[model samples]
Every structure is written in structure tokens, then in C-alpha cells.
Target: MTQHTPHLWSRLRYRFDILMAHGTPVLIGWLTAVCLAIVVPASVVLVGASRDVPTTAAGWGAAVWRSVGQTLRLGGEVGSPVYVMMSVLLALVALLFVSALVSLITTGLHHRLLALRSGRSPVLEERHTVLLGWTDQVFPVITELVAANADRRRATVAVFADRDKVGMETEITSRVGGTGATRVVCRSGSTTDPTLLSVVSPHTAKAVLVLPPEDPGGDAHVVKTLLALRATGPETRDCVVVAAVRDARNHPAAALAAGPHGHVLSVDDVVARLLVQTSRQPGLSLVHQELLDFAGDEFYVVPVPALTGRTFGEALGAFATSSVVGLRRDGGGMVLNPPSDTRVGPADRFVVITEDDGTAVLADTPPAVDEDAIVTARPRTQAAERLLLLGWNRRAPLIVEQLASYVPSGSTLDVVTLADAAAVRGACRPGRLDVRFLRGDTTDRGRLAELDVPSYDRVLVIGDRGHAVGPDAEPERAADDRTLVTLLHLRDIEQSAGRELFVITEMTDDRNRLLAPVREGADFIVSDRLVSLLMTQISENRHLAALYDELFAAEGSEVHLKPAADYVVTDRPVSFATVVESARRRHECAIGYRLHAGAATGPAHGVRINPDKREPVRFGDRDTVIVIAED
Candidate 1:
């Protein structure tokens, strides 16, 4: 009949906690009562042993009740007669009930205390990075944190998600390697709950990774988390918060919510951009992997101390181990494949890529051949190509058009898609791509082999719509699985047709690169990691992308794993000094390289790329080095 005060609910929760805490004790007490109810009476009826004897009602009553005091002597057998026996039973029951209650109470208290101690409790910590919704993104975010903190022995990442606490912990344990010094802890809570936000110590976390779930519900959750994290007050605020929106339409809302709180990434827009890039240039996805993987060679802003007054070309050769590929400064944008005269200045940061640690500049690699064999002429190929896309996606058509623009126009493309050929044709821009859609899945090896997959120089495996891999699918492993099977089938077809294939797949994850079973097979688009690196680089400077484009361009830029002998004037343990002079002579940038220490077959047989990297390089005829040379 009456409305309860707000305090009542709080009090009720507290009391309920207490009642639950004594659960063990309650059970013990009930069990003792039941025992006494049965055993006490049964012991009292000792006369039941001689049931045949006729007994008067009064006699029976006296035997059972009147002389009950005699039972006190039995108690005295152990202690103070009646008091001792009663005390024994009562004490045992009391102890059981008390112990059970205490245990239950203590366990709850411990959990509550633990939740508070960890940053999960909102009341204590504020402004820490508050990750809103959690999904696959959590894995990468955690992985990056591990890689980013490689210099440190330990790191801590607190996760807050809608998942159950046990489930969250278990999922993280299973997905992320269990044997890591860095600890990942999860709290069961919604992103919108500011109270739960405290438990993660959001006020202090270096950065928060907000991932939306796979479905629509996850989108709403991310949006709410963005807004809530942004609203934290100034003192406990300013922590970096990064979020992703599933739909492009949610971008503005997410951005507004993340305003000043941190940064927001629109996955759709980025995916579209990468698709356009991958379509134009094959193997750019592999480029993306080297860029995205923190452990592998990736883009970094190295201060070019020796090159304040030098050109990018001179500065590029200045670092013994690291290469100055591009420039980033106060006002200058990223200039990829910059002109030879691009000047390097103090404020200008050199975008150098390296692996494992800070860029370790190796001395220049020596010239493999003399000026006579060094072909200064560009290795120009036949104009354009006839590319056939075995699939369609947001990236497929773009990739076709890109190939057309980047490659010579005599190049024609006939698309093979399950989508409508007529509509695909109608939507097509004139002369860009000749649209011929076939209704079928590329996964079918037999059906796929029938198509001329090898005739074209390039074939892209685009996922079905809504299923396309994007920033989330880095190491585009699944895409590669589909692509690999298609490739294996195509490789067979190519073998049957007596032609070697140059295939490029657009995969989301770089990890899939190793999965392509076909030897020296196809170039893959590890877009996920590539996009990560691109975003990271761009965040530092917007120009890096253009420079990236040039370095990755098919006609203008190239990355070739060259044999060390290719750089040797003679076979000797060579100093990068000789290598540097030779690379500059060749008008090329020699970044880090792989070593084929052992083997007689294939490319860099048993090559070791990132080991004992500090040592000088020597080359045998069996080994090859990767060089970025202009065509």
C-alpha cells in the first residue's frame, strides 16, 4: 500500500547478502534439528527391545518420561550428566550452523572486496579507459597492449563487458595465451554502468578499446558506452577512449559521444578505403600485415637527428638499420615515395619501419652486381591486364576499377559474381570493368577451376556481402581459408593450363598469410593489421597513407625479397656500409631482411628473418634479399 524509500532497497540488498552468507549454517542447523527429532526419541524408547512384555500405560509413561533424569547419568559418562549431553548435541548443531553461516558470509565478502580492490569498482577509480562493449576486438586490443608494453615485464588490462564474469575470464584465457606476464582481468557489467566503470579503474587506464558486438544490440551498447565514458568529469576524465561503430550511419553519433573523450573509428569507412587500395594494388594486404604487426617490421616515427638539412634520399640512407621511407612534421603531410629532393627538417619525423624493437639501422648492404649488370632502365612490363574477379563485395568492384586505373587500360576485367550480372552490368562504369556475373560460390574448387582463374594476372577473393572481412578480421585467416581453397583449386587449374599465377587475396587478418599452403603462391590482403598500422600511422601524421600508397604501388613501388648475393660484390661477411652505398647506388631503400641460412631449394630456404639481427649479413648463392626497387 505504501512506496518504499530508496534506502529500503539498499538495506534489503545488504540484508539479503547477510542471509545468503549464512546459508551453510542454516543447512547445518536444519540438519541437526532433524537428527535430534529422530534420534532423541528413538534412544528414549529402549523398552522396544522387549515388545512382547505386557506393560501398563502408567509404567510405560514413567519409563519413557518420569525417569528421564536417569539419562543425565549417561551424559555424566562424558561430562556433567544432563547438562553435558544436552550441551554436546546443542554445541555440535550450533557449531555447524555458525560455521556454515560464517563461510557463506565470508565468501561473499571476499568477492565484493576483490571486485572493489580491482579497478572494476567505479566508486574508487574514474577516468580510466572504459571499454564499452566487448567482442573479437578485445583480443587484438589485448594483444597490442602486450606488444606495446614489450619493454615492460608486466601490464594490466581491465575488461568490462555484458558477458558473464566467468565467461569473460574464460574467453579471454582461451583466446589470449594463458602464459603471459601481463594480466587481463574482466568484470561482469554493462558499459553504461558508471558504477562498474569504476571497477575497471577507467580514470587511469591508458586507453580504452570499445568494440561493438556483432549484431545490432551491440551497436546500441557501444553508443551508450561512448557517451557515458565521455561524460566523466574533467579531473577523472581525459583518458584515451577508442571505439568502433558497426554501421557507417552510427559514426556521427559515436563520434559525438566520443567527443574530446577520445577517438572513434568507423570500420565501414576504413574497410571501404582498404578495399579500394587492395583492389588497385595486389599484395598490399601483405604490406598491411608488415605494417600492422607490432612484432614485425612496421611504420614508426623516428627522429632523424642526422638529417636536419638533408633530403629524404640522403636521410633514408643515413640510418644503418632503419630506413627513412617518408617524412612527418608540423605541417607537411605524408609524402610516400617522395621525390628525391624532399628535405628533412628538425620537426619532421621520419616514418621508418622496423621489427621487434626500435629501428636498428643496419649498415648498407653491398652491391650484388657491378654497374654493368645493374639495369638502370625501368623493368617495364606489357601494358594493362585482363583481370577476372572470382567474387564480389564492397571491395571487389573497387579492386577491379583500381587495377584498371593503376594498370594500363588495355587491361580488361570480367567479374564472376553470384550477384545479378544484369544489375552489375547496369551499375558498371563504362570501360572500367566488363561485368559478367556468374551465380556461384568461389569456394567450389571444381566449379572454380572451370573458370579461367589463372589467365588473369590478378584474382581477388571478396567475401559475400555483409560477410566481408574488414578491420575486425585482421590476419584475414578465415578469408584466407576460403581464398586458399579457391587458390589451391586455381593453382591446379593453372598447372593444368601450364601457367604460373600471380594471385592477390583481400583477407582481413595478417595471420592468414602463413595459412596459404600454395608455395610462393598468392599475395594476400591482411587488411585488419594493415588498417591498424595505417590508422596508427595516420594518427601520428596524415601523410603516411600517401607515402604508403607509393611504396605499395605496383608500378611505382615494390617490395622484393632479394638474395644477399644480389648485393655482394664478393662472397664475404659484408658490412651494411657496403650495402648502403650499393643500395643508394641502385636508388633503392634496403630495410630489414630475411636470411636463408640453410637449404638448397626454393626462396630463401630455411630463411631466418628476425633473429640475431644485430649481426652483419653474409650471403651465399642460395640466399636472396628483399629489396624495394622501382619498376
Candidate 2:
């Protein structure tokens, strides 16, 4: 009997499992039907057992109706004990059935809601920006997009990743605060999965950004995601796609995967180049940030038929507010800071620096040139520099290579790191630079003091990349902490010696940049944040890639912040048009000026770009003029 009972219960449990396997709606409906079946029959039996009910069929039907009414507390009265008992029994049975049914239905509905919150449902947005993959780079990209779309009536950015949708939303909200008019939506799914990619409605998207993951296998994941995006139908495949690749070796493969309409930015190479450039020029990073970010003056390409016959040099003075930088050829090519004699072709588009596209208009009359204030004498030659590079990372080698091109012959570069010196030497090419390496921990004050920090003309602090204890550990945080410690020591040593030292530090995250000790004269290169801004900018304007490439490369005309005294007399009020004329006399383009007294302050730190050309401004002897010239 016991064995038979176990078998019977097992069969019943199997049948119940099958019934529950049907989805939420079906399960709720089945529960409702089961409750009704039990309640109705039980009510009929109770009526038959009642004393006041008759035995005939008509009497039985009437009694059953009365029993149901009594169970529902609608028709019957509490008369005799037997009648009362029968009513109470039927009422209890109905209560039990209703309680079970409500519980089942509520449970089913809750589970269904949970499934929906998992981001499995498809989006119905059009002309939106779609972001694929999740990493530390996502927040900066979203923030930049929000600022870029601030003027729009409505803008939507949809994010897809293999993470919890609710969690992603919460983290982004906590980090970014209010998104203004831009709506940011997050979905949970693998970026490489085609079935899941459809949920973001790629066909309706206007642009797509693919961010590399934080793991070591980031390149593989990015390639797969790009491939998946390309596999989407022709409608989505034609949309503009921008991706970031960490390794330069993967550029060819990623570019191939991205096809003709896509732009692949090598993050390591870009950051390395920026670091080397900023090391020489203290405020160069801020200039790059202003050009890339939407909150400041950004690069804009617009067709100006009025200046079709003017020379590129003549067109520079045509804009009252916008600063003309270059021209875009008609057949989809870009030239930044072209030769002065280059004529503006009929089909060419002017690349001007302006607050917005609508404000990039040409002035009716060019500002008057001040020939007396212009200086035609060339600046003195650059002497050999004593450079000290502290710490090491993947970008260290590239920094050395780029630095070699800028530094003069007989310049000495000292690289100090805990890493093997031989390996560092092998990676660098011996140009005119006298390169040497020392193995030591940079965070130690004693070790730093031994290097004599104040003696070097420039100091660069590189964040450690090997601080992570495991594959999933947070390494950037630890590396930044170490960098902060090293900066504190360097600042103390410099203050004790009472001398000025130009310092440039590389940071992994933007939030930590504010926490560094030496904030005033120091420059910070937030690798990921800059990359994120560049990716977003290129995704919006593809021609910008070529413009920035020329700006960062060593062979072209680059932006430089020269002494204000080099252009005009100090403390004398002079119009910006006079400064422009002075720059032109020296075969250069003057964009703006920096106030030395206010260089350490907030906001723009006295770095003004694209000022009104007709306004007269007084410049101090120590102030610097922002210009573009061949060095």
C-alpha cells in the first residue's frame, strides 16, 4: 500500500508540473477554471444535503440556486441550525477557492512583469543612437550624447549589453545625474547575439557606437559585435558605425569587420599621442577636450558659397565669431590647416570652429589688419630638454616614440619603472633621444627624491596597468590611487625646492582626475573619457576623424600656445584682429589667448577660443596666444 501511494503521488505531481508549464496567462486561466469547477459542484452538493430543500428536480435546482446565493451572502437567511451549518460550509468552500485563485493569478502576473523587466521586449524607437556593449566607457559616452542633444526637442539613446537592465539604469542615473531632454534606455542582452540585437531596433537607428569591453578579450568581443551589427539587414548595415579598438594590431581586422562606412579608433595609440603632445605643452589636453566636447567650441563643416573665390588665408578673417581652420573637399575629403595660398573651391565646405552649426556664418566685412603690431621675426630654436618619465604602462613605449620626434638632438629621456628596463629599451627606437631606464617603485618618496624631480624640465606620471590581482578585479582604481600617491610626493618635493616643473599625469577614469593633489598647473589625460568623447564625436561627424588625425600627427600644422608678448606689446590693449594679423605675418593662425594670472582658476582657466575678432583686449606679458603653426 505504501509503494502504491508513492507512485500515485508521483503521477499527480508530474501532471501538475505539465499544467504549470503553460505561460502566465494560460496558468492563471487554468487556475480560475479549476476553482470554478470545485466551487460550483460543492455548492450543488451542499444544497442537496440541506434540510429545507426538496428532493424533486425542480426543487433541487431551486435549492442549488439558493445555496449559491447563501455562499455569496445575497439571498439566504440564518434560520435553523441545520440551514445555518449548510450555508456556512458552502461559504467557507467558496472563500478557499477564491483565495487560491487570487494567489495564483497574482504570482503569475508578477513573474511575467519580471520577465518583461529583463529587457527581452523589443524597442520601438526611430532615428535614435544605438550603443552596443557595456564597460567603463558607457557613462562618458552617454553624458556626451546628452550634452550634444541638449538643444534637440527629443533625443533617444538606447544601450544594449549582457547585464541587468535595472542595474545598468541605476548605475547610469547615479553617475550621470539628470540627462536633460535626452532619454537613455538600457537593454539586457549579449551584443554579439543577433536575436537579442533585434530588440534594440537597429534598422531604425541613425548611428551605432560599439565600446570595447573591460576584459582582456575585449578585441575579440568587439569584433564579434561588429560582425553581428554588419549581419543586420541592409537598412541597418548602411547606418554609420563607430568602434574603439584597444590594440593597434587589431585595427585592420576591426576595420574589415566594420566595412566602408565604419570608423575604428585605436584607443592606445590616440592616448599615447595625446600624452606625448600634452607633456610638451601643458594646456594641450584642455584644447583637445574643448574641440571634442559639445559644451565648448566644436568643429563644424558648412558650405559657404560667398567665399568660393577667396584664398584659405583670406577666409580665416571672414568669420566674426567662428574661426576658420580648414576646408572639406567636395568629394568627401578633409584638409585641416591647409597651405595659405589654397583657394576655396566652389564645391568646398569650410571647416570652422564655432559654438554651433547655425552660428558659422561669414562676416560682411573682414576685420582691419594692424600691420604695425605684427611681428615677422621667427622665435628662437628649441634647446635640448631633460625629461623624466615616472611609472610605466602600455602607452609608455608609444609616448617615447612620439616624444623623440618633438625633442631636439642631444635631449636626454630618463624612464623609471618597476618593470624590466631591457624590455622598455627594446620597444623604443633610438632617434636623437638619449634614452635610459631605472627599475624602482615610483610611489616611494625616497626613490622619487633620488631622481631630483625639480631638475627635469618636464615630468610625466604613467598609471600602472598591472595592479589588478585577478582577471575580474578593479585594476584602474588601484592604479589611479597609486598615481595620486606619486603625485602628492612629487608636489611636495617640488614645493620644497621652490621651482616650477611642468607635470602631465595619465588617469584611467575621469572621476579620479578631480581627486589628484596637483590640480592647478598640472595636465591630466583621462584615457577612457577622452576616447569616449572622440568616439561620440566621430560617430556624429565622420570627417572629424581626418581632422583630429592631422591635428595629432607629427608632420602637419599643430596647435600651440605661444607667449602673448611674442605677438604684441604687453599691457597694451589690442584688437584680436591685430593678433590674427600678427600671426599671419609669421605664417600662423591665431585662434585665442590665455591669461597667465588666471591659468590656475576654474571654468576655462582664462583659455579663450574663438573670441570676437573686433573686440580689443589687453594682454599681460606672461599670457599666451593660442595659434596653429608648423613647429
For each candidate in the order shown, give its overall lDDT on alpha carbons: 0.57, 0.83
lDDT tens per residue, model 1, 1-631: 9996678889999977876688897866876687657655864566455564327874554454422334422221233457656855775676678889999999999999876544355423432233456655566666765665567676666778767766777777787776366666667776787655655766676566677575545557778887666555442333566666655667788878776545666655555455545554433444455556555556666665656887866665555446555567657566544556777777887777666335545346422323432223235455666666766554454455445555555667766655666656654566644445566777787677677676666665654442332222322344456766766677677778887666656555456656665545244555444444444443333344456556544447555555555565435666544554455566666554544344324333343332232345666665554455674
Return the clash pairs for model 2, or none.
none
Q: Which digits, one per residue and each the tens of the lDDT, describe model 2 over residues 1-631?
A: 4554458889999988988887799897997688668767998888767777686986776676666666555345346768867876777687778889999999999988898789888889998899999888999899999998999999999999999999999999998899999999989999998878989988788789999876768988999998888776663444678998877778899999888888888877888888888887878887777778888888888999998888988888888898888889989798877777888889999988899999998788887766667654446888999999987776677889999998989999998877766777887788999999877788999999998889899998988666321232336678799899999998899789988778999998888888888857468899889989999988777788888887878878788888888898665688898888777767788888888777788767778888999988888877889888888
TM-score of 1: 0.68
Cα-based TM-score, every candidate: 0.68, 0.84
Location of the lowest summed lDDT over 10 successive residues in candidate 2: 465-474
What overall lDDT, based on C-alpha atoms, would model 2 receive against the true structure? 0.83
